[model samples]
Target: MKISTLITAAIALAATCPATAQETKTVKLRILETSDVHGSFFPYDFIERRDAKGSLARVSSYVNRLRQEYGDNVILLDNGDILQGQPTCYYYNYVATDKRNIVSDILNYMRYDAATFGNHDVETGHSVYDKWIGEMNAPVLGANIIDTATGKPYVKPYTIIERDGVKIAVIGMLTPAIPSWLGEKLWKGLRFDGIEKSAKEWIARLRETERPDVVVGLFHSGWNGGIENADYTEDETENTAKNVDGFDILFFGHDHHARKAVVKNAAGREVLCLDPSCNAVNIADAEVEITLRDGKVAEKKITGEVRDICNEPVDSAYMAHFAKEIDEIKGFINAPIGELADTIYTRDSFFGNSAFTDLIHNLQLAITNADVSFNAPLQFNTKLNKGKILMSDMFKLYKFENNICVLRMTGEEIKNYLEMSYALWTNQMKSPDDHIMLIDERNTGDMQKFGFKNFTFNFDSAAGIDYEVDVTKPEGKKVKILRMSDGKRFNAKKWYRVVMNSYRANGGGELLTRGAGIAKEELPGRTEYESKLDMRHYLAEKIKSEGTIYAKPNKNWRFVPEKWTNPALERDRKLIFKR
Candidate 1:
């Protein structure tokens, strides 16, 4: 009699239950990600002063259309590196601090579900990013970023969302390589942990606690460790997704290379990985379908792709909404700063010294009063035509906001640093026709596409010292120092003060650590001085004070075996520069 009563109760309960719960339920989730969007907020470029090929304004149309169809099922995510690119951000970051940050207003307007912090965001310093964190509508997550005093995560580690009763959890982590790239003052009160370790721990904890159906890993990191070892793994994104379980999809950036792939984890479960290159050029998207039987998840399918935002038409409404702010930024960037005597080309830095790279080197030497200065061509394949120089032109001159540093180093160490730089920069030649630039052979053409074997921003050159790089000699034997530029006796054993961007002084390029044989931990003690603001600030001030300026190369260094190097250089130059 009691069993029969229970059956009657069950039948009655089933009759009153929602019809959808009784049937096989399927929920489709579209996860969209934008990574390394370094301030291409609008459809215009503040520095270039032209219509941008890709911008968030154009992406807004795509995003709005998806959301209209999918509603809340369309989950929008932003992987970091948003705080530092165009004057769009720089204006709000510094110029207009009295109001809420424009980035905050922009992200909130777009309805981003959650965001992560990139190394560049942290480079904005505590005053900037800390304020940005408070203004964000959604959580700014960093699972591996630990607070020293509290011994816990600094930002929200993960966020959970429910779409049609399907639980989706997204965990965020930036590169643990910040210490190697940024100064301590920028990332004060926080410490970074290895991404793989943090990933494994968080996945297990979330499984035990949240029991989410889908897991996503959003990382502002690269796919491979480049020229760095023993200190930290710069690119732990792939390793974490391959080795760790529970992650269904992973998104990464920071190298600004776009790709999508599927890899099997330790449990032999497939995990989808994707990244959109920087500057809103592309957006990473993933489609997932979950089948539920009897209220239990039965099966799941996932696929990933990168969509081009360049061709998308700008959302007129979106552009109109930010019109006032856009016009203000335009006025600021276009304001004249000074006059230039001659045009400068960044391509010239590749073969030898050029006015483009030397302008920065000269500024660093003058600002720090150091005996030697090291600089690199940050803005690759760019140019500044000789004429009235605007504030925007200054940005083209110095791409990143990096602090300048003065360090005490022996003459021998400086040469060794150059040796390592040249090793990554140029190739040894045997014949007059042999290539000198280290072009990536795996690319379409060894020299046609101009794809270097390494990052061009890391190709460092020096001023204040006269040196010769022999193309015929091997890597270590290429550099030979004579007298100083001023004709003073150069002693290899003597120590001299050197000026360089904080990125180099902090071992961002591994020039000082791996090349000079200085341990990564010991770099802090060698620093004699470091600028409080970016070197561009001083450059702008100097230019404004002078009103007019002449730009020229130091011409203190050159590649030897010119007979052999010259022919190859010209050949490669034509292929790269299209001359």
Candidate 2:
């Protein structure tokens, strides 16, 4: 053949054959996640009645920017806790009682790709959540939550998304600790399973069934324990990632923490993990660079980051779109309930006797007419300035969906219950400089540094007994019940009716079971009465009927050894109140 013919033939072969550039192509697939949002769709803090730091509106701004930069390959997911947090969620759940809640509407508006149920999401009860599931445009997922009738996942376990010929499989798992914390009525007909076990099963199934290029774990749990060998629980997202083999990225929430890291999975392969902190405060971002060879993934590079949304520009279009709904929520929340003759603040409740908790205690005693009452400051930080009280103020006073109950208990049982309350309330101080609060400072650090060790909802106190908590004394001996508020002798053997919330009656905080020596199974038998309406409702009615409410601490309890206690209290109070 001629040299020209040979050159032409070689050029033709090169053009027909797969070139180096044709063999491989890179695609940037970004996954943006919002976990434990707890219904912070608007930037407004409904409780405080002010503009707040975090919201989906703010996250939407970041999402819009990311979409602009990355285009159609970006995926958005919410890690749950959406059904029951702010006033908007509360309004829809209880007050309005719509077929499709505003929360589901808000999520649908945000165009969530997929979501999982947080334990709190289930706490909204079956009626609300069941209807909510129907309203979502995106699939709501929870592989671990099984329907009793079908013996399968109550919701979709996972979703497969194919973007530009690249298949990405996302599996969702919820924390299995719902049964431990919530009543059966809340999570009725559904059973929660362990996270690690569920992930292992689902990951294997996804790989075998979907044959996806990438697998993602959308876990509404925490990154705490290492693996399933020694540690196992519902809040084991980290354990699932370490023990499960196929996942490329794990987005976790619940326990309301913020973090980002790449850790080794069961096969000793790097897996990206991201946690967006609660209340829409941050966005967990997983950016993946996938190198495709012959229409399949050849190389995968995953980078995780937590982006703080504080003071960030919010999406004005998103905010404007939801303006009417926001206004309706605001109108509903701002309606006057009654008037407070005096201001009440939650900060003072940490010091023992406070007007804040006394308000709750007073309402419980008035309605139930029980000989004793126990209540806690549910809000960590809130203040009701004197004068007209609105529905929003009622939420700040008692934030949970708890019913008040009257429990029949002996004086001895009451003492024991208070003992447990005080033990968790204050630590036994060997020295004045030692921590007054039972805080894990090493792991938790300062509240300013690491946030509160315990949520303020758990800090309970007695309101019907004249008692003293001697911080210097040991745990069991610290609570000294001098007498009843009516000056009756505190007889240990005599039976007395007590009014407390259903949470305590059902063994929340273990005060009744562990402290009072009441069997967990036997707690239901001791309840003399239980309110159908929530405690907040009763409080609101009482205030409304009277038109004017006087708020004052009964001074039913105090910490003893004022010299040692005073200094420690002062230091600790300053430390906690710094923020």
Best prediction by lDDT: 1
How displaced is residue 343 in candidate 2, in Å? 1.4
Q: What is the alpha-carbon lDDT of model 1 when measured against the actual structure?
A: 0.88
In model 2, pairs of residues that clash are none
Q: Candidate 2 lDDT, tens digit per residue, 54-81?
A: 9999988888888898888999998888
C-alpha lDDT values of all predictions: 0.88, 0.82
Minimum summed lDDT over a 10-residue window in model 2 is located at: 442-451
User: On a 0 to 1 TM-score scale, where does candidate 2 land against the true structure?
Assistant: 0.92
Residue 100 Cα positional deviation in candidate 1, in Å, after optimal superposition: 1.4
Writing each residue's lDDT as its tens digit, candidate 1 over 440-550 gives 745422111247888788899999999999978998999998878889988899999999988999988888988888887788999989887788888898888888878
> Candidate 1: which stretches are off by over 4 Å?
1-21, 441-450
Q: What is the C-alpha RMSD of each candidate to the true structure, in Å?
A: 2.9, 3.4
